[model samples]
Target: MAVYTQVSAEALAAFLSRYDVGDLVSAKGIAEGVENSNYLVDTTRDRFILTLYEKRVAAGDLPFFMALLDHLAGKGLPVPPAVKDRDDREIQQLEGRPACLIRFLPGVSLSQPTPAQALAAGCALGGVHAAVADFEPTRANSMGIAQWRPLLERCGRDMDAIRTGLFDRVAAALDAVERDWPRDLPVGAIHADLFPDNVLMLGDEVTGLIDFYFACTDIRAYDVAVMHTSWTFNARGLNPSAGVGAALLDGYDRSFGLSAAERAALPVLARGACIRFLLSRAWDWLNTPADALVMRKDPLAYLARLDWYVANERAFA
Candidate 1:
């Protein structure tokens, strides 16, 4: 939701002209994402999400991510379909912004999901995995553990005053994760950022998933762990109740069951999962400009998760 790219009103209207979408009726910043500048665009004909990707989203990788979403939707996965433009392109320049148009899927985001809704998000994730596992295009793991090493190296200073600082424990946990991470449970493509904001639902059933910026070739369970980070946590960002984790785990297990070894690995993966988010939150905290519309998602939440892992380390790692 950060307005990184400065787009004037006139410039936005001009970008709309390239598409079949007639006459931009109204356009305003749909500032709800940290990675992209989004405008909920209205035209005489319909409503659309116009995304002006931030630097975090590499321009080269847009096609693969866009195609993957379309592939999943075509297979009946609940998600928005990328709108191909007049030049038969999925992405176009909007106000000097490297942007793309997408058909908005209908639904409410499951902020306070029911057991049914939480469970469905789990099921929908599995369905999406089924739909996307074999899609051939590939991209770098933008938010993966491997990618975190450099950031952690640069930003891994002291945070000992904090009750939930993971800076000390994470170094050791990361080593174990790197060494023992599952090599062959099932690997293909996965929606790496299946957070609540990215998932849309109508009532208890899911409608679609957005924000494939983090999708990549990775271990399936790791993706599950990544998703579990958001859905499994409460407003305070700890597990809301044990039942939340159990429910989400149950729903995911229904789709992609885990083995005894995989189950043994789940805690560590979940810990790894926490660190992954902790690092990203730390990065955003350190880097976000004050006026940025995007609120920095809390790093302390993940740090608290790390402390939770250290205290109750047995269940997961």
Candidate 2:
């Protein structure tokens, strides 16, 4: 959803020639996200999204990512399907980076969601979990609990620079999460990063659920925990409300009931979610160039969220 790598018109035209998608009309960088270099591509025949997989994405994992999209889309989720080229390939090399094209989906992402929208997001996530029930492929959660500490360690002394005494607090939280992280919740393929920007809406109606790049096998409830942490926070990161959390859980449970264990572990999982994002944002904040095509996110935003979750673990219940 961002453009770290630049693509020229001639290069794009050469790349488009390999596909039967038609002649390229225009290509524009999309600067919304912090991950890959993305562009909205318009061709004579259709509009598609071109994503240049950056180093953050492992090349070995591309097959799993693409196949999962095909599975979810085939199962009738609102996800965009990856476009295949004339060779029937979902991936190709462009500018020496792994890239792929996906059919452009309608609807826009919402910054702040209503309770009804929260309900729809919950239902959509639940539906994704159900749809992938029979999908044969499995990829481990690359950003799962085990990786958080290492991410923090990589952040190292740089974290203290972000906020005095911030490293210790985050380290303490990471340790606590590692100690109490759940083990036996129902396991399935999950859309691990379901932030509001990843969900698309047409007014109050849920129209699309994009970005399956973070999909992996993990506790289904942990996915719900991501939703709780992401969707329940208000603007300015001051007010973390339970009403949205309640509505989301209510909607999800209507489709897939949560186990006693899942419910009990939700608070800890919410803490883990906060830790995951905080570490990632902090890492990006420290490493990514200020003027990079990608907008570096503020780690303090998630730092505030981590603190909020620590104080209001019961709110996620």
When superposed on Cα atoms, how far off is each prediction in RMSD? Answer: 2.3, 1.2
TM-score of each: 0.91, 0.97
lDDT of 1 by residue, 85-202 (tens): 6888888876566788889778867665667777888887778777775688877687777776776776666433333455666677678767866666667788888887788887
Q: Which residue pairs collide, candidate 2?
A: none
* Residue 189, model 2, lDDT: 90
Summarize candidate 2's per-residue lDDT along 1-317 as a digit string, tens digits: 79988999999999999989899999999998888999999999999999999988888899998988888889888988888988898889999999998899899888778888888888888888888889989999999888998899999988999999888999999888888998878899999999989999998777888888888999999999998888988644557666777878888887777777888899899989989998998999899876678877777877788788788767644
State in Å the error of residue 197, model 2: 0.3
Cα lDDT computed for each candidate against the true fold? 0.75, 0.87
Q: Candidate 1 — which residues are off by over 4 angstroms?
A: 158-166, 313-317
For the record, the alpha-carbon RMSD of candidate 1 to the native fold, in angstroms, is 2.3
